[model samples]
Target: MHELSITQSILDYSLSEAKKHGGVKIREIRLLLGPFSGIVPECIQMYMDLLAEGTIAQGVKIKATTLPLKVRCRDCGKESEITRRHIACPFCESLRLEILSSNDFIIDSLEVDTDGD
Candidate 1:
């Protein structure tokens, strides 16, 4: 579903970056995936397989690293890591918390072949 459009964007960005770096082939893409970002790595790989055909981005391996969920307590203003099941702030025992991480998907880096083929 949403992974389709997101994967397309990833491919587009990868191609753009590869071209900028004078790369002839994109070998791999490193991704930082948030735990609660709702993005499935398998889905993205499937979409990328379809979308990257005939492009320099084809045959690209996606390496996704899941990030931990961290939140800041509104009362104590302290950041702590917590699981998705339990969201309460550990320091102040307050229900009000501001999410600091685990809600975003980011492209970290790319491995590309710069040699002329």
Candidate 2:
């Protein structure tokens, strides 16, 4: 599925970064996911576990945090967090809104073993 590709990308990026930093292994991976991104953390984890076999990222701890959808009202210019179902501006009830953060898929941080121990 799509999770497989995404997980592959993550693993590749992580491995590249670890190598750049002279890391012997990856210890942890922290992810920031958006509510509207439609990326399932569990699926990502499962795919990572499968794809990381015999790699530096094998057995790495994966932590994912889902962020709320934030939007800015065009009418009142107020930023507010809204549920995925309701995208309208909460303050002015305006349908005109600019999405601030909703479809984000970011790698927040990575813990790598650079000591080669």
Candidate 3:
């Protein structure tokens, strides 16, 4: 799965961050994933666990937050989350809405621990 590569990238980035702080070890990583990001959270976690097997994040935790799906209607000038299959605008019943949200996969934050000097 590509999540392996994804986690590898995460590790690379996290390691860079650790370096910036005098090589402090990371305690956990938090991610924000939208519904339309097309990534399964469980799969990411599984891949992360495998990819981090021999890294500083070996015992770290990966947390994910799911974002909502929001759309904007072109005809009725409405913006909201829609999931009824009938993608028409709720105000004018026009299927001219365009997706406005639920299309992001991002790393939100990192928790690191630096030993006492």
Best-fitting candidate, scored by TM-score: 1
TM per model?
0.88, 0.88, 0.78
- Candidate 2 structure quality by residue, lDDT tens digits, 58-102: 998889998878889989999998877777888889999888875
lDDT (Cα) of model 3: 0.76
Candidate 3: pairs in clash: none
Q: TM-score: which is higher, 1 or 3? A: 1
Q: Weakest 10 consecutive residues, lDDT, candidate 1?
A: 95-104
Query: What lDDT score belongs to each candidate, Candidate 1 first?
Result: 0.88, 0.89, 0.76
Kindly state the number of residue pairs that clash in model 1: 0
Q: Rank order by lDDT, top first? A: 2, 1, 3
lDDT-superior candidate, 1 or 2: 2
Q: Tell me, what's the RMSD of every candidate?
A: 2.0, 1.9, 2.6
Error of 1 at 83 (Å): 3.3
What are the per-residue Cα lDDT tens digits for candidate 3 across 1-117? 767777778778888887687656788889888776767777777877777777677777888887766879888788877654555677788778788875567888888877756
TM value for model 3: 0.78
Candidate 1 is scored at a TM of: 0.88
Question: How well is each residue in 11-83 modelled by candidate 1, as lDDT tens digits?
Answer: 9999999999899999899999887888989898888988999999888988899887888999999999877
